[model samples]
Target: MTTVGFLYPGHFAEDEFPRMEVILDTTIRLVVNRTEPGEDDRRPDTLRTLGEPERLAAGVEELRRAGVESVVWASTGGSFVYGWEGAHGQTTALARAAGLPASSASLGFVQAVRALGAARVAVAATYPEEIARLFSEFLAAAGIDVVATHSGGVTTAAEAAAWGPDRLKELAVAADRPEADAVLLPDTALHTTAHICDLEELLAKPVLTANQVTVFEALRLARRRTWAPQLGTLFAAREAPPAPVGWRPAGE
Candidate 1:
């Protein structure tokens, strides 16, 4: 079985980790954020963002000790605000620390979009308009166009975590753009996987989310990239072969 390590906050969705099990039959080890004494809640208070270089480094060490074959940061806000270079640096650093392949939710979304041959994507987010614009720029760098964006101003990670699958489905319906080829629900904090099949049925197109695509890429790195019909349409792809086994980044 493949070992996929997740670095994320202590709070998570019930549907998030189980989707990986259904798709890959993989074991997930989570290295969660350790909060200070005053901060009991694992949720963010505001749009307030902070750098976590040291925490990520520690999480990498924890995953290495666990002997994980692949590691991924399950938080999108942590990686995305730093822009492309920040995300790239964090993934490279984690790969070196664990002596395994590493990626983040944002990068996984990019790779998934590219693999699906999608030129235009509709965005569904729980963030504000400014944060959505940041994600749009990141996707544009990878040659994917953001045809349309939708945000309901749902701030704080905890608020997103509390939103149920039915709400996520409704959001997808409202966010879908007729001109776009596919819809990307890019939030690891938000629960979207359980509604994947339902959303695809409603839209008659592909529906991808942060956690599902992150696991998909981790499976690819582990050389266990088999399609799972339950995960969504992206898994139905059959063209590309899995990467070489025991693949580590250069100079690691």
Candidate 2:
């Protein structure tokens, strides 16, 4: 079995990892270690602390004991708020601290978008407009264009975690534009694994959710491939061989 570790921030939506493991039913093992909760706001400063190398490093021993082959910092806002270069450095630092391959949700989205051969996408974010815009900027740096964006104005992970299927579908439908290649939901706090296929079907396009790509990235780092149609188009598509050990997606 390929064991991947997830260093998740706070308590919200980490359950999605185990839920995914159950759905995937593959040799891939998802082991999550929760980092201490920080201020719930999405401000740049707050997010910087949330994704701090020290905070991520503090959780390394738990994952190491779990025998994880790779580690992922599974918080989209925390990572993207750092900007592209900083986010790359964040993963590098985490990998060094964990003594294992490391990636984060923001980077995962970029790789997932490229893997789907999509250049343009629509963002459906639960963060406020400003924070959501940062994600758009981050994607642009990676050569992905944001055709449209819809922000939910949710201020905290607690609020986002409370969002149910109806709200998620509404946000995705509102965010999608005909010109976009796929719709992205970039909040790890949002519960989405059980609804990925439904969201894609509803939009008639690929729906790349934060937790989904996070897991996909962890698997990529572990040099493992899986076929899980239930997880939506990213997982259903035949993936190429895992990139080399130190591979960073194009703009890193």
Say which candidate scores most in lDDT: 2
Clashes of 2: 0
Q: Which 10 successive residues of model 1 have the least lDDT summed? A: 243-252
TM-score to true structure, per model: 0.83, 0.94
| Tens digits of lDDT, candidate 1, 1-252 | 456676765565535776557555434333333221123222333221332555666667766776677877766666777678877887887677667888877888888877777778899887777777777788888788898888857756667888887888877878888777778888777877667777777777778887788777776666666656567777764554242233222112
lDDT score at residue 64, model 2, on the 0-100 scale = 96
lDDT of 2 by residue, 171-192 (tens): 9999999878789999999999
**Reference-based lDDT, residue 92, model 2:** 98
Clashing pairs in model 1, backbone N/Cα/C closer than 3 A: none
TM-score, candidate number 1: 0.83
lDDT, each prediction: 0.68, 0.89
